[model samples]
Target: MQPTELMVCTQHAPPIGGAFVVPAPPLPLVPHALKPEILMEAIALLATAVPLALVVALLCATVVCLAAICRAHRTDVVAVVQALPDLALALLRRRRP
Candidate 1:
């Protein structure tokens, strides 16, 4: 084919990069049911309630953790004290070597 025909064919072909563009849809004009004042009040109540709830949860968790730690420490102390005789004998044997 002639160069002019090729040029004409290329010009008539679908434009490049056209697929990348998209037209935005029209927005609906409906008014919101929750107004700014109601939103702010709800947010304020949530802010207060969330921190209070968190503090209560933290206190409960801390109490549980402390109780667990105390129980574990007591058990460990008892075990270690019971083993004192064996530990002393081992120490004496090691010193002679």
Candidate 2:
């Protein structure tokens, strides 16, 4: 039986002192030159939306923190109880054959 050979190919390095890991060209800059009315409407929309979004996010984060704290306490108790058998086994090991 003959072993199969695998081939790998890579891009040739740029002709220079060392290989060039050139990065992609930067994206073209966009001018945010909005019309006066469009700019005012965007500002108004964000002014109203930002506070509402913050309030909702704060409430959700608070709920998640409370739930996580509750789960942590429950897990701590479960871990202590679960460790009892291992503790007992260790204590009983001295008398084992």
Give me the runs in candidate 1 sitting further than 4 Å from their true place.
1-33, 73-97
Provide the TM-score for each candidate, comma-separated. Answer: 0.41, 0.40
Could you give candidate 1's per-residue lDDT for residues 1-97 as a string of tens digits? 2234224332344434542223454565753537778788989999999999999999999999778667787878678779999999999999995
Task: Write down the TM-score for model 1.
Answer: 0.41
How many pairs collide in each candidate, listed in order? 0, 0
Output the lDDT of residue 9, model 2. Answer: 22
Which regions in candidate 2 have their CA more than 4 angstroms from the true location? 1-33, 74-97
